[model samples]
Every structure is written in C-alpha cells, then in structure tokens.
Target: MTSRCILQTALLVYFSTTVLAVNYDLLRFQLSSSSVECQNLLLQLNGTTKDCIKDRMNFKFPEEIEKPQQVQKEALLLVTLDIFQKTSDIFRKNLSSTGWNEIIVNNLLEKIHWQIEHLEEILEKIKEEENFTWDDRTLLPLKRYYLRIVRYLKAKVYSICAWKIVRAEMLRSFFFLDKFTNYLPN
Candidate 1:
C-alpha cells in the first residue's frame, strides 16, 4: 500500500498541469499495475469523472431551455407593442373628428385595460421567477411597455383637447344668456 501511494503521488506530480490527460486508456493501464490500492483508486477516480461530466451536462441543458423561453416571451411583447403603435396611428388620425370620439374612446379604454393586464402579468412573472431566467427577449416587453405608456399619454392628451373644444363651445353659448336676458325689451 505504501509503494502504491508513492507511485500514485509520483504520477500526480508528473501530470498535475494536464486536466485532460485523465482518460480511460491511461486509467486502465494504472488499474492493471501491480498495486491493488492503485486499482481501487482508479475506480474511485472513474466515479469522479462521471460526476464531473454530469455537472457539465446539467449546466448546459438549462441554458438551452431558458434561452428560447426568453425569446418567446419577448416576441409576444414586441408584437403587442407594434399592434399598439399602428392602432395609435389610427387614433391620431381620428382625434379631430367628433364622429369618431365615442368609438375611439371605447377603443382606447379597451387598449388601456389590455396594457394594464399585460403589464401586471409581466411583472408577476418576473416576481415569480426572480433570476431563474434571463433572456434577450426582455427588450421587447420593456419596449412594448414604453409603447403602451406613450399610447396612454397620447390618448389623455387627445381627450383633453377634445374636452377643451367642447368647453369653449359651451362657454360661447352661455356668454349671450346673461346679456340677452337682461336686455329684454322692456
């Protein structure tokens, strides 16, 4: 046993720098050497090699699964944002017309509801996962969120402008009431 330990120690010193040199062929040769302890040690080393391989494989598989999950989530958000931008263009075109006000308001409200729901869902997912996954797809969700925010602000501005016009018309109509009532032919 002492001689076997000495032999293994000497081999370790010789091969210390070469991590890849521990192969089946080299191990088989060592196992067949005269020392019983060397043979047992070679079997134990084989188990360690298997464990190292398993750790590497386990490390790579999750990355493969996680990457595409990120892409899928991000693509959904990007497409949702794009649809919003196009829908915004329509709202922008129609904002000046009284005829489109009710329909646009309804549509804008629905879009707001959707954005809120999606944003909540996204936030919930992030909270739930919390560093379990990372993806390039995140850019799209964040961008979509930006688009929705812009849409919301634009809608509010249009509503304000439309209300201002209505308020001006009401003021003009009332402006004559006091003067006309007081100047009634006596």
Candidate 2:
C-alpha cells in the first residue's frame, strides 16, 4: 500500500539521521586526529581535565612534555588549572603517572557546584528586579570582558600545549607575562 511505502521511507531517513548524530563526535575525533594542530587543540581542550586528574592522582606529565623546563611546566600547570576549572564533565579519565586525579577532580567538582549556586542567586535577583540601575553602561563592559576571556583562553590553548611547540615569551603575554614584554636595547 502507498501508506506502507511512506512509512518505510520515513523510517529509513530517521534511521540514517540518528546514526549520523551518534557518530558526530567520533567523526570529529577522527577528522581531528589527521592534523597535528587539530589533534593538539583537541588534546589541550580535553586534556585539561585529563591532565588535572593525572596531576591530582600524582600522574606524571607525559614523557613528551616532561623535559627539563621545570619552571615552564609549573607555570603552565597553573594555566592548565585555570582552563580546567572552566570546563570538565563527569566520568573523568586519568592521564598522569600518579593517581592524584581523584583529589583534583573532587576539587574541580566542588568549585562547579558552588558556581551553580551563585548563578541561581543571580537569576533570582534578576527576576526580582525590573531593570538594573546603569544596566546598559555597566553590563556592556562585562560582556566585552567575557568575550575577551573566551578568546584569551582559546589563544592560550592553541599557542601553548596545543601547538607542537609554543614559546614561553609568547604565552607569558596571555597570562600578563610583563617580564618578557620588556623592551630591549640593541
């Protein structure tokens, strides 16, 4: 029957769509793996939580980044912590030499929990008020700064750990590394 034919066609379309949706992330991972920059960026973004978990669990840095730059590694770890705090989900995996990942994961989760509470308070306050005093002028700067934060964070990820090789002087500026910015005389 015609009705049966329509149902079959619809079902076929739906099946294909759902299958693609499920594999979207896997496709992203696969495509990204082909390129060095893409892989590193993915690693930087995903590795934030992974590395932090490793750090907390006493996971040692991968031999790749565990070179003699002790100061560089420590400073970069601070940067790593900041980015990790901004993003991470449950079901974390360890990527370190030690098992200190649990402690840091707990800490990161606690911070996220508190942030949700704070957001709730803000939402409640917004509902109670019709308009914020000086809202237009005051909120614009905040919005700009928030956008800047996003770019700064991305730049840090790409230029640092994500890149095959990134320079300290270059990264120093992202975190306000003023010392490296000093002008030199010829």
Candidate 3:
C-alpha cells in the first residue's frame, strides 16, 4: 500500500511538471505565429502608404535589445513585453487618428494586444521557474524612445506622413521581435 501511494505521487508530480513545460512551449509557439501575422499586416499597410522617408524621427530602439544574443533570456522576455505593452498603448492612442483603413488598423491593434497578453503568460511562467524579478529601470531607454515618438507625432499633429513613418517603424520593430524569438531558449 505504501509503495502504491509513492508511485501515484511520483506520477502526479511528473505529469504536472510535464504539463507546465508544454504550456510554456505552446504559449511561445502561439506568440511566434501572432508575431508573424502582425508583421504581414504591417507590411500590407506600409505597402499601401506613400513613403515618408523625410519624416523620420531621431528616436532609436533600446541598445540593450539591439543585440538579443548578449542579453539573458529573462531580460529579453521582460524587455520585449514592455515594448509590446507600450506599442499597444501608442497604437490605441494614435492609429485611429491617422485616417488609414479602420478595419486593418483595428486588426493590427487586436493582434498586438493579443501578443501582449501572451507575453504576460510567458513572463509569469518564467518568473516561477527562475525566481527573479525584473527592474523597472531597465525599461527607461524604451520609455524614452516611445516618448520621443509620441512627442514627434503630436508635434506633427499626427499628420498622415508622420503616421506613415510610425507605421513603417512598427513594422521594423515586429521584424526585430520575430528574429529575437529565434534566439530565445526553447
């Protein structure tokens, strides 16, 4: 009877860990697919718009994330999550005023929002496994980057050309994220 109880307990623990790991993998896969979808949608929107090369802003993506290979996996995940969260907020606040096709812009927002939620789930799992907390200060550079973009848009009065440049920049961001995911440990 004792042996039987021990066997059952061990099996339960094994299956629990297995399921948790599988869930993490599933979330990552879903996030990858969603990221690709976002890129395609952005590509389509960018293609339809006139080039705004001269309207480029002086802001840059955070240098820490520029080289994903050198960053720790947890730091990468946290920073990526922060970027998506900020991007979603910026999109919700600005995209509607851009005079673009409403349906496509809304669809893009929905995908981005979904990605944020998915990243949150992945973050929670990583927190549990790694027992670590991320510093908010790490996101200072990203916040500054977004702040500059927002100020630029406001200064331009959210003109179509300005929005076009922002849209292209977002496309570039998604492209980077898609590539960054490849470097993450599976």
Candidate 4:
C-alpha cells in the first residue's frame, strides 16, 4: 500500500510538470502565429496609405529584444510582455486615428490583446516555478522606443502619414516577435 501511494504521487508530479511545459509551448506557438497575422495585416494597411510624407521615424525594436538569443528566457519573456502591453495601448489609443479599415484594425487589436493575456499567464507560471527578479532598467530601451513613437505621432499631429510610418515600425516589431517565438524552449 505504501509503494502504491508513492507511485501515484510521483506520477501526479510528472504529469503536472509535463502539462505545464506543454501549455508554455502551446502559448508560445499561438502568440507567434498571431504576431505573423498581425504583421501581414499591418503590411496591407500600410500599403493603403499614400507615401506623401518624406519624414522618416527612427523608432525601432529594442536591441535586446531583436537578439533574443542573447537574453535569458525569463527576461526575454518579461520584455515581450511589456512590449505587448504597450502595443495594445498604442492600438487602443490610435484605433480611430489610423484612417484604415476599422474592422481589420479592431481584429488586429483583439488578437494582440489575447496574446498579451496569454503571455502574462505563462510568465506567472514560470515565476511560480523560478524565483527571479527582472531589472527595471531592462525595459529602458523599450520605453525609449515607445516614447519616440509617441513624440512622432504628436509632432505629425496624428496625421495619416504619421500613422502609416508607425504601422510600418510596428510591422518590424511583430516580425521580430514571430522569430523570437522559435527561440522559446519547448
């Protein structure tokens, strides 16, 4: 009876860990594919904007995020979560300003919002398993990048051309995220 109890306990632990890992991987895959779809949608919308603005914006993805291999998995995940949250904010704020098709833009926002929620879930699970603190400074670059975009939008008076450039920059971000998903541990 004692041996049977031990066996059952061990099996329970094994299955729980396996299920958690699978959930992480599955969430990563879902977020990756969603990012790709968002990228394509952004591309299509950007193409619709007339190329009348000659001014170029210098905003871009943070270097650390661009090179996912160099950063630790936990930190990468945190940064990604932060970026996604910020991206959702941008989408919410500029939903009507893009001057693009409202339905498609809302669809993209919904997808990103979903990705953000799932990422938070995965991160919370990992945090429970591994106790580690991420530095606030790690997010400085992202904050700076986001600030640049905000400034650009304000400078351009949220014009259609300005939103077009912002959309193009966001496309680059989603492209990097899709590639970064492959780096996540399965």
Q: Pick the candidate with the highest TM-score.
A: 4
Model 3 poorest ten-residue lDDT run? 44-53
Instruction: Give TM-scores for every candidate, taking all chains together and pairing residue i with residue i.
Output: 0.25, 0.25, 0.88, 0.89
Query: Per-residue lDDT tens digits of candidate 2, residues 21-128?
Result: 323244223222222232232333323333333212211222222232332322222222222233332113222322234554455445445544543443344334
> What is the C-alpha RMSD, rounded to one decimal, of candidate 1?
34.4
Worst 10 residues of 4 by lDDT: 44-53
TM-score of 1: 0.25
- Report the C-alpha displacement of residue 97, candidate 1, in angstroms: 2.5
* Candidate with best lDDT: 4
- Candidate 4, superposed: residue stretches over 4 Å from native: 22-24, 46-50, 95-97
lDDT winner between 3 and 4, please give it. Answer: 4
Per-residue lDDT tens digits for candidate 3, residues 1-186, read 999999999999999887776254565677578778987777667443446667777579777667788777667777778778877877776565566677877898888888888778867886887688988777788788888888888898887788877777777777777776766666
Alpha carbon lDDT of each predicted model: 0.36, 0.32, 0.75, 0.77
- Runs off by more than 4 Å, candidate 2: 1-106, 122-126, 129-136, 156-186
Task: List model 4 lDDT by residue over 1-186, tens digit each.
Answer: 999999999999999887776365776778788888888777667454457458566786688888889877667777777777877777766546666787788888888888788877877777777666677787889888988888888888887778877887888888888888777775
lDDT of 1: 0.36
Worst 10 residues of 1 by lDDT: 55-64
TM-score, structure 3 vs. true: 0.88
Tell me each candidate's RMSD, in Å, in order.
34.4, 21.4, 2.2, 2.0
CA lDDT for candidate 3: 0.75
